[model samples]
Target: MKNFKNKVAAITGAGSGMGRELAIQLAEQGCHLALSDVNESGLAETVRIVKNRNNSVIITNQKLDVADRSAVFQWASQAAKDHGKVNLIFNNAGIAFGSTIEGFEEKDFKRVIDINFWGVVHGTQAFLPYLKTSGEGHVINTSSVFGIIAVPGTSAYNASKFAVRGFTETLRQELDVMKCGVSATSVHPGGIQTAIAKSSQINESLKSLGLDPSHAKDKMAAQFITTPKKAASMILKGVRKNSRRVLIGPDAGFADLMQRIFPGAYQVLVGKLLLRRMR
Candidate 1:
């Protein structure tokens, strides 16, 4: 756990953004990679990048949907078999949705939960046995700043990420109590320059809020304070240090502090921010 060299890492959502950056950075550290993503081309690109960086490092790419429990288990088994052993599982696959409970359909909410919450659960559960057997293992689950503080139009996303935070935190404690070498870290990232917002499923709530979709998108992008590479670096540092929680970006740190100092008032602040965006 202290070093990544020659260690095998299995990453979900390894096609783009932080996941892809994580793979690249880990490759630079001489870590072998097993990467998965629903987007075949993106996964291929990541694979190419990693292999280019370290031709000697083992690299495997699979088209995967983390929401599928059976598929995740099968992939984890196959990955372990292919690589001989696995040391880290980065349960980083997630989706973004923008809608209030009143505006979003039940199915939409369920979809977010399946990929964002259950996906983490599935990844951790599926790979845990292999990780435990590896003797020195780690689990890094990607949450979000929204996980710590609720937002107006992201109820489903908030719910899913909060569940992830709770799940990973409890898993860390359990691992500690069991005296296992495997550890878990929950990551909360603020806006980074990623395609997540562009790819997000936004409900008609934007229309009701009197916000133009394009303008809203621009505003979201403008809020980004970090790059995926930087986020990846911070995340890897956290993993190396066995940090219980990793907060990425200054905004994320600020949000965590604000929540800690004004838990109840934070909701009001978010509401005001939403109202401002509506105008």
Candidate 2:
């Protein structure tokens, strides 16, 4: 963990966003990588970018859906054998699905929960043995700023991310008490420029909020993101220091502070602010 040089990292969602950036950063330090994503082109693109900087580092690519328990377990086992002592596993793959309670379909809800929530669980549990065996490994799970507070029009996503936050937090405590060498980090990131929003299954309630799909997408793109590369750098820095919580943006830090300081105050304050225009 202290020395990333020549260590191996197995990252989920390595096709894009923070995952891709992590690969680039780790590869720059001469760490070997085993990257997985559902999108072949994006995966190849990430590998290409990393190799462009350093071709000597070992790079392995796999097309994986982290929600598939059998596949996830199989891939983790194979990756340990292939890479030899996987020192890091970034459980970073996620999807966003926005919907109201009554309006969301079961399939849409399940898809978000499966990928955003269960995917983290699958990756952590499936890969923990290998990571533990690797000695001085770290597990990083991506939660969201919304996980600290339920955001409007993102109920399903909020639920899944919140679940991830809770799960990772508890796991960290258990590991500490048991004296596990592998430390854990829960990432709370404010909107980064990713395909998540573009891919959201926004429902009627979201549409009724008078947010033009195109305009909202553009606004999110412009407004609150910390760059994927910077996010990756922060994550690695946190893992190096074995920090329990890593906040990636001003928005995330603000939300985190309010959540712990005045959880109810922010909750009601945000509710009234959002409802003022509607009324």
Candidate 3:
């Protein structure tokens, strides 16, 4: 919102990466923070950093697993009660499952879907009431460049991010129909340096599949990815502008264009080479 000063903002996955950075940026702008993550230490660290900024706002940190629907709903209710109202909800917690369909494990598959897809569902649905109560609010859901275009070896991740994009788009339309001031925006970040590349669950079958998670991380990190803080600032700009779809990174904007204008060309170009690289 234009008047971020003194407004309350709630974020999921606020322990590290872009989520934590978003909390800091919003706090710097005078927004009160309600930060949640499964990592209690990380959440506390985020709160500590935000408080150190001399923000004239209260910061709350909670250990939350966004995939737990009941917990998300309960905490959302509590957050609204404690903060008075929430003007922004960043449903941004996500995981990466770097597996080809053939090499993917069921456990990792479910974890990716639960955290990346259902987590957004839980966060959006849980916070909507509070968002509505605030009269006007914004929802920022992290999809990925993969959400729009699927390359090889990341089916599970693509599915979850694609679901988030579609879900957030539908909510945006619904908000319009219902004439609610609350709006939803989907995020397509190219490759911000996040732990998902390495810390992500990659099954042991990768060696058999001739894939290396370590190589994946190294290749990704070499992309000279935008910092989490930069991504967070871009996200805040998107929220302020009420963007329908915010694409981050220099590569992401190009990818989005190619996706819309040259989907079939983009497919053939990235696919065969990408599949070969995977193996």
lDDT score, candidate 2, position 268: 79
Candidate 3 achieves a global lDDT of 0.85
- Among all windows of 10 consecutive residues in model 2, the one with the lowest summed lDDT is 270-279
Clashing pairs in 3: none
**lDDT tens digits by residue: candidate 2, 1-279:** 676998999999999999999999999999999999998999999999999999999999999998899999988888888887788889999987655677788899899999999999999999888878876788899999888887666788889999999999998998898786888999988868777667655655556655554455544556556889889999899998889989888878888887889877897776565444433
Give the range where candidate 1 is weakest over 10 consecutive residues by summed lDDT.
209-218
lDDT of 3 by residue, 1-279 (tens): 666888899999999999999998888888898899999998888888888995578887778999899999988988998998998899989887677688776887998899999999999999998898888888889999989888766789999999999999999999979877898899999989887676666655556545676676555455647889889889888888889999999878877888889878999877765556555
Q: Which 10 consecutive residues of model 3 have the lowest summed lDDT?
A: 201-210
- Predict model 1's lDDT versus the native: 0.91
TM-score of each: 0.97, 0.94, 0.94
Q: How do the candidates rank by TM-score, highest first?
A: 1, 3, 2
Best by lDDT: 1
